[model samples]
Target: MDLHMNGGIGEASYASNSGLQRMGIMKTKGVIEQAVSDLCRNNVNFPKTLVMADLGCSSGPNTLLVGSMVINAVTNTSLEMGLKSPEVQINLNDLPTNDFNTIFIALQELQGNTTNGKMRDVHHQPSCYFTELDEVNKGNIYLSSTSPESVSRAYLEQFQKDFLGFLRCRSEELMAGGRMVLTLAGRTTDDPRVEESNRLWGPFALALQDMVFEGLVEEEKFDSFNLPQFTPSPTEIMNLVKMEGSFTIDHLEIFDVNWEAWKIMKNDNDASKMKEADDGVGHGVAKAIRAGIESLVANHFGEAILDDVFMRYGKCITDKRSNKENQSLVSITVSLTRKCDI
Candidate 1:
């Protein structure tokens, strides 16, 4: 279902600083190092410095946190190899719709704390640039985007195409053997448990069905309950890479994040536990559902169904624990590098 969230991530209510911090995803240093190392391997004229770009950088917090981690990782790795620290350049790339005010505010906060120990006596501080795709050019060091919206097929296809185009642009801009690291949400090659995929929304849907049976929601409006699957699996990503023949699959791995922390506390059985899974897996769906319900209640059902449905979903998801056999939310991060022709 289509959602109606007035304010998105930038809104104070949706993605607060503290919420993101607590998620333990701010540390992207390891991934960055892997991408760079793969790029520099077997290179004849290795760059003494690196330039990095992060696409869809909603705000500086995400980029700053990732940059700091990358810097630290590079320093540690160089020290272990007994080599001098590498110079670094970082860029924050995002759409014009981004909250530049918050991003600038965050960047200002991180600027003073930047350390450039890699360059000798020459303050090797990393230079940061912010620009949109139209302005970005060739030879950037890195690029990243973690956007989660994949509603329409057209939008999804465009997203895939734009990603490839950006990488091609970055590859040209990069020096010989330069690397670009990208992380995005992905689906599994065969989703080991396909049945459990949609299980997350069972309870919520059932609850809504109950409401529909009670005449709280119209049957025609119920048609908005469509869910689209967009997370491309690691294999699919590899295929895209092969098809494009631009970037190489240097370091490709996928792992799951347990965002079900709050879900287990709410649901206790498989049916109810499914709702917990929905909270994480069907996030977009849940958002759509909530938006649909909110719109209906506000327009037709009155305010009564709002609290009624919300409390039902919340209580079921929060109070019940998973059946111990069900699959919950699993976030996959794919890391790739630019491949050079021999």
Candidate 2:
């Protein structure tokens, strides 16, 4: 799925439906804070003008939230050390089709006087894929426990190329000793198809299979659909960083969050109502997944079945939750520093 093209202000737009992603970002705030803190502390030649980029920074509140957090961290650290606060240059990057207008508007609202020097400049890069992959794997690469080894191998190869290329580009841009903090959905196990990794997609895929059975979507279409996502393990990420040879991993951590944890918390953390909340949690997770993947699914299965497909998926997730069979989603956060030039 072209995540940039698919997200905007529409009902299925990522901006309207990315609460789950925001929660993941929130979970990693401490890591981000520490990374910024370390950057200020360790770099004696810290730039008087700081340049920071948020990669894959999809639109909406989360985009600005990250920038603000980073800025706050740097500001606080500089104050603590009696250093001058640097002029910050924030670059929010995603795909060419991302709803940048929304981001710009939000920025204007947040910073009324751009000339006041709080933010120096905002540059948009229209084309930013660090590595390219074939679209042929579109519908055929579901990584379930029963998935073939060949599928897993192909996914890993693609990931390695993409990650290495990303690191190379960033290494060139970042000054020596600059720091970066990244957070993404990831797996705790090397095995990609384990329940923790595929908890959401497995049920969603089964929902599609049901549609094929009922003639709602063509079996051929179902057979060709593969999600354009990879959740790498910590070892894989470390290996890529070492192989790329441009950056050093300073810190890495993996954390588990229940699919329904955010939803439950939103409802005031009422443990006494656990039974009633189970179904809600299932539907909430299903909705989040739908917002993320609906664009790709609609592109393949026809937009006509969008609602029906999610309904089935929601029920499937609900059943799993009610049976206490669902697993928490795992997230990984990494802090890295550009290797000093020899």
Clashing pairs in 2: 138-226, 139-224, 139-225, 139-226
- Could you estimate the TM-score for every candidate? 0.59, 0.87
Question: Candidate 1 at 97: error in angstroms?
Answer: 2.4
Judged by lDDT against the true structure, how good is candidate 1?
Answer: 0.47
TM-score of structure candidate 2: 0.87
Task: Name model 1 segments beyond 4 Å from true.
Answer: 1-14, 17-29, 38-49, 78-87, 108-176, 189-196, 199-222, 225-229, 260-313, 319-321, 325-328
The lDDT per prediction is 0.47, 0.73
Candidate 2 positional error at 260, Å: 2.3
- Estimate the overall C-alpha local distance difference test score of candidate 2: 0.73
Kindly list the per-residue Cα lDDT of model 2 for residues 12-58, writing each as its tens digit: 56665565666677777788889888888887685588789988777
